[model samples]
Target: MSEQLPKEHVDILLAAAIAAPSMHNTQPWRFEVEGHVIDVYLDGSRTLPAEDPTGRAMRIAAGAATFNLRCAAENLGYGTWFGLAPYPEEPDLLARVVLEPTGARNDDLLDLAAQIPYRHTDRHPADATPLADDVRVALLQAAYAEGAELTWLGETEVHTLLDLVLDTDLREIHDWHRRTERSHWVGGERTADGIPSSALGPRSTSYPAAVRDMGTRPADRLRDERQFEERPELAILSTYFDDPADQVVAGAALERVLLTATRAGVSASFLNQPLEYDDLRTKVQRLTQRPGNAHMIIRFGRTRTHTGTARRPVADFLPEEQS
Candidate 1:
């Protein structure tokens, strides 16, 4: 076995991992450090049955956290090796990551680590300023580097996606279970985990909003309503398959893309309502007209910096013995 990482290094790694974005900032991942290996697990209790009945989102969140761990290790001058769904018996074990000392480190990942603390979901309306061509290509390359494909939607495709989002929102309007789940994790006072109302952004005044409104209750109405940009830039991140492992790949690709955007002074938010339903998810995939299952719907543009959501301490994610 490789030499065990010191407690301080493990703490640094876990802090970066939990900063990853989840469906509603659930931070639904746990870590176990044995020697130099970090086992990533889905905290099943954090699963949103109504919002994610199949646990796909939870696995994706785990994958994203794992990606952050890898980046942090690289930044710390170590090479990272990881496998997804490595054991059949341990279904919740989403990934197993091993870090080893390497004389050379991945400069790309190291740069991404610097942006981790700044990468937050920007829920506010973005300006009409268009994304530069180079920035767009870089975001695409980031996803490709992680074995995933990102497709930026055209005007017609964005319209189609907006329609799907509207349909999904209408369907969710009466889903008491889903609403309750969202209420628990999102809005209200700032908690160690989950997004708070302050980060929810202003409600959209237009119908078929380009961004998915995070507001859940009548209290959300008290926030100002603003008109979102008419032509919001959108992209879909996907993998060739829809298996559990592929979902993790999608999440890693997502964090890479998001961090890349943050490095370029661009802001992003998710319009993922359509992806929660199987039928709507299929339609979202069709919008891309590509050969992959859509895992995330991202809206990227320029916006002012907003207060980031809070995260639990590193000890909160460790086992009792480790803590």
Candidate 2:
């Protein structure tokens, strides 16, 4: 049977959920709580039609939020049972989670919960130092635990992937809609949601940047320029299918790997430009030599500390009746 969680517990869970990273920090999620049941919904109004025409990125972000909700529940001595797209009639409802009182806790999830506040997308150049083998193994295990595959790319594969990214970037340069949409959420004045200029990393001095250049405006040109890593570590996170449910699973796996990297003192960022195109996405899957749809291209390494983007208060996500 479900238990009635205190308001304080609900607050912590919602806070953790909103902390999950989204593309351009859109933070496109909503919540409703009744007793011990928490419903997660995709805020359709927040969608970036130009960049995320298929809504794949939004679903992934919702999945990340769901994972965080579970972790927070476990941390508070509650076991969670959740389902993706639980209501067929309510297409916007992405997930429904029930909290059950469990005296026992998931130690692994507890450890991950502790790292939540520390995990941020690092856009600056990472140190050329490679990840330790054991660390790589842990990241793989983290993904497997969440029902996804994380494949580390080889030097040649990384180069090939970089070529695809460059092609996508060139295509985006001429796409006015995409450029405007990206700028809407990134490299602007600080806001409650979306990335601020302060967190926008320096521009890369070389082409085929390991990091996505988020500086999209003339004012952004004034930002500092730095040399990014020549051979940065890269990995691909994939799922067995391209369905909405599968995308949610991919997001959960992505967050697990991110938190694991954070606990190991590794910084991470995304190179998801290629994944936005169908052909380039297929090529990315080919790089894996594995049977799955590529969802994200993650770059992991050690880097100097950087501030995380801001998030809206939990109250903003609650429905009017609940609020």
Quote each prediction's TM-score.
0.98, 0.98
lDDT tens digits, residue span 1-323, model 2: 54566878888999999999999999999999988899999998899999899999999999999999999999999899999988889988889999998888899998999999999999988887889999999999999999999999999999999999888988887799998898888877876988888888998998887888787778886999999989889999999888898899999999999999999999999999999999999999999999999999999999988999999988899988766
Q: Any runs in candidate 1 off by more than 4 Å, and if so which?
A: none
Which regions of candidate 2 are displaced past 4 Å? 1-3
Q: Could you say which candidate leads in lDDT?
A: 2
* Backbone-clash count (model 2): 0
* Lowest lDDT block of 10, candidate 1: 212-221
Per-residue alpha-carbon lDDT of candidate 1 for residues 1-323, written as tens digits (9 for 90 to 100) = 34779898899999999999998999899889999899999998788999899998888788789889999999888899999999989999989998999988789999999999999999899999999999999999999998899999999999999889888988987899998988888888976988888999998998888877787767976899998999999999999998999999999999999999999999999999889999999999998888879899999989999999999989989999997
